[model samples]
Target: MRRCNQCIVERMDSPVPLIPQLAAHLVAAGGKRLRPLLTLAAAKLCGYPGTAEGGTRHVALAACVEFIHTATLLHDDVVDESQLRRGLASANAVFGNKASVLVGDFLFARAFQLMTADGSLRVLEILSRASATIAEGEVLQMATQNDLGTSVERYLEVIHGKTAALFEAACRVGAVVAERPQLEEDALAAYGTNLGMAFQLVDDALDYAADQAELGKTVGDDFREGKITLPVLTAYAAGKEEERLFWRRVIEENRQDENDLEQALDLIGSTGAIAATLDQASAYADRAARALAVFPDSPLRRLLADVASYTVSRGR
Candidate 1:
């Protein structure tokens, strides 16, 4: 963890003062550090010798993964026009979009530098592919926005690319650095992918169910942005003709009135879309746990399993 922090600090030290400040602010809005933890835990679970210096490469790689993720968040806030993130004002909201975007680019370049310093072509390949996939996912989601025809299949593809790909790469890269067997590396990669998918599904569910304070953003944000997520998609699919018409008007026609929020919530509830979304998330969680069955049992493995369990139980 200290190594990861050092790497972050080193990357943040920049000739451009504004870049460092913005990067610091974004980094201070800390998350679960689940990506780095996944890397460290994967190394341990793969039976890497527990020497004081054994996992330094994994730690560095983990930090690199987090840097890439945080950089994307800064840019995403700008693109999404989001005000709040992690319970505080987003970098773009505070520093303006231009600064945010440039700083995000700085971080991306720094992450690349870190990866190159590691000198592992495998790590570079995984991260480069994940970055491309994330960009593609963002574009796909943009294309599908406000379109009621955004099917479950399309939604899954978007989330897998946008959210799960990085998580998958993190775990796989850790295994690669630890010199794990090919089969074990594949299993960990699958575990990360499914876990990431489940994690995003739960986030979509909470967007409807959680309070503004708890969610750290406005409820119905996706809907207000004309973005159709799982709950709305499922509800729209199962709703009555009049209910479908309501969704079409709000989502497709972009005709939301003040009363539309309650109407949308009621319709989603009526169609049990939230429950169905929960079921889907739960299934992905189960699949993530199943992916770990090939690995030998250890504390790290147990923690990974617990993380899978917590994905469904988390508030946001």
Candidate 2:
């Protein structure tokens, strides 16, 4: 990631000096770095050779994946009007929305530059398509915001596009760069896709589950933004007449006020929405684990499965 930032700064000569600063701010702020790890793990699992004397191609590609993920986060914070990220003031909050958005674009450009440097059409194709799909997912989520009629399937589609596509691409690139067989490539892709789905599901649930200090953002941030996540969908579906009215007022009408979030949480808990969402997440996690059955038993394979398990439990 240090090298990734160096690459980013070396490429930036825009009129606004803070463009690099704003882009680098969140990157400097640490994250779990799971996507890049997945990429590296996939490469290593597929037998990509790396020695102390010689460099590995996977490092650059892994950095590229991080750049893509960071770009989305910058854009997402602006769109959601978020104030906190990773337990710190968000890029938008610190740099202003305009700066954040522009810097995010800069990051996207940098990511593509890295992709092109790798000199693989397959790598470029996978990452580029993932980028486009992520944008589409965000737009779809925006369109469905606050709509009570948004189907569960539609919600799944949104997460798959917004979150899972990159994971799928990340692992796919690992296989491509490693010259792994197509079957192994497909297996890693399946693992990534399912893991990404489960990751997002738990994230959505955690919006209501954790406090600002714990979650790195304000609790009920999704509620304030009027985004329709699975937990809200489940609760609203199972709610009684009064609970339904509450959802309509708070979500559909965007008429939220003090104590409304608490009421919303109470209703969600009473309806077992959180548990049900976690159950759905667990199903995806199971699929992620099952997808790994094709790979020979190794620490990496076990680690990937452990990641799936950890994701479902993270919100708790």
Candidate 3:
């Protein structure tokens, strides 16, 4: 992880002014770095420590994973028009949207540079496909914005592309580097895909109910942005006709009054939307845990399973 962090910092440095600074503004703020961690752990599980003894491929790949993730975050904040990220001014907010987007593009280019250096066409294919899918996911989300009629299946499709695709690639690449069998690679990808789903669902639930301190961003940012998430969908689906109208007003028409957030919260809470969303997240979390069953019962496998279980707790 330390090596991956250092690699991220080093690779992000550039002679071009403003790029590194803008990238640092977001990266330095710090995030869980969970995607890169998954790469390392998956490699270890497949019998690669990514250290001096085994090999150093995992470290660079992990950094590449992180770079891909950070690039997405930079783009996401601009698309969402988010002011805060990790409880600090977002890159788009601190710099400008144009700078943030360009810096994000630079990071993506750096990621591909790392991939090309690795000389693995397979790894290149996985990461490149994930990057493209992420863009499609973001565009799909935009298409669904303020769409109260968006189904849960459609929501899952968006998250699978935007959030889960990188995770799946991160883990699958681990096996690829380790020369693990195809089944193991498939299992690791499944673990990542389900885990990513759980993580995003919990995040959606948290957006409606968590403290700004814990959430690291505004609690009602999703609501204010008219982003269609499962919680709002659950509430809107179960709401009375008048309540549905309220969803249409705030979510579809983007006509949120000062008290509307509170009202939305009440409806979400009263309709058990948060709990329902958490339960759905729990289901995915369990799937993530089950996906690791193919792996031998080692500490890494156990730890990864624990991570799947932990995603459920994060929502609570």
Candidate 1 TM-score over all chains jointly? 0.96
Clashing pairs in 3: none
**What lDDT score goes with residue 284 in model 2?**
93
Ranking of predictions according to TM-score: 3, 1, 2
Pairs of residues at least 3 apart in sequence or in different chains that clash in candidate 2 = none
The digit string of per-residue lDDT tens for model 1 on 1-316 reads 7777777788789887898888778778877788887887787788665448565787778888888888888888888899988888889899999999988888888889989999989889999899889889888989999999988999999999889999899899878987878999999999999999998888888887788877877688888888868999999989889888999999999999999988888888888888888888888889989899998777777889889989888733
**TM-scores, all models, native as reference:** 0.96, 0.95, 0.98
- Residues 95-208 of candidate 2 have per-residue lDDT tens digits of 899888888888788789889999999999999999999999999999999999999999999999999999999988888988988999999999999999999999999998
Whole-model Cα lDDT of every candidate shown, in order: 0.86, 0.88, 0.91
lDDT of 3 by residue, 1-316 (tens): 9988889889999999798788677677899989999999999999975477859898999999988898898889998899989999888888989998898899899999999999999999999999999999999999999998899999999989889899899999999999999999999999999999999999999999899989998789999999999999999999999999999999999998999999999999999999999998899889988998998898889999999898879878
Worst 10 residues of 3 by lDDT: 48-57
Model 1 lDDT on a 0 to 1 scale: 0.86
Candidate 3: list runs displaced more than 4 Å.
none
